[model samples]
Target: MKAPAISLLAGLLFGAGLAVSGMADPARVRAFLDLFGAWDPMLAFVMAGALMPMTIAWLVQQRMPRPIACEAFDLPGTGLLDAKLLLGAILFGIGWGIGGLCPGPALADLAIAPSEAGIFVVAMLAGMTAHRITRG
Candidate 1:
């Protein structure tokens, strides 16, 4: 169908998957990330499980007649790991560690824990705005 419809369905399905997998729960995510503190490995298994399907999906996409969106593939052709890229990754890791929530988890949190999600989203937006202002 239309791009908007496809995007909406994809987002709904992704949110549903996040909810079903307990990614929305910041506590659980934090516990998982705290390898030295709690040493939980279930999250690793969950991530591997998620990756397997995506790996098969990639294989299928390679054999498809054409892209689902009917557009030419415009995959990034960059392998350059510049300073800016490294710094951004460091910042992202710090934020994730501090909040125990990233884009996917933040979106999923809207259904079960709106207050925390709202805070995370607002902060994320503010950071983006601040970066734009500072960069310009």
Candidate 2:
């Protein structure tokens, strides 16, 4: 119960931050990616802001035995990058560049821009499903 509530709160905060930072806007994100064209640097500030807290959290996690709501610390394995990892990253980058919506921003835009966000989310889920099917 506590863990779920904390997760919900964290998700809500992340969504709110995405919205407030203009990341939920596909146009803004697209603009940010346009380096040779009309590039916007606001996204850099937002990324920096997010990175600070995340870095601190990671540092704190290294010192803590376990999270407040969890019995164990389940960190991702620090393994060498493989072909699958490279392919997944390439796919993710292509999707982000073309759609101007990554998972977080796309999910955040769901309430505000349902039509566009819905399409992206559906496609993303389909891609995930395809990956699972292919991996298995």
Best by TM-score: 2
TM-score, each model?
Answer: 0.88, 0.95
- Residue-level lDDT tens digits of model 2 in 1-136: 9999999999999999899999888898889999999999999999888888899999999999888999998878899999988988998888888999999999999999999899999999998898789884
Query: Which digits, one per residue and each the tens of the lDDT, describe model 1 over residues 1-136?
Result: 6767888998999999888887777777888889789856767788889998999988998888777775765567778998888999999988887898888889778778899899999999999899999983
Stretches off by above 4 angstroms in model 2 are: none
Taken over the whole model, the C-alpha lDDT of each candidate is 0.83, 0.92
Q: How much is the lDDT of residue 16 in candidate 1?
A: 90
On the 0 to 100 scale, the lDDT of residue 47 in model 2 is: 89
Q: How many backbone overlaps does candidate 2 show? A: 0
RMSD per candidate (Å) reads 1.8, 1.0
Residue pairs with backbone atoms closer than 3 Å in model 2 (clashes): none
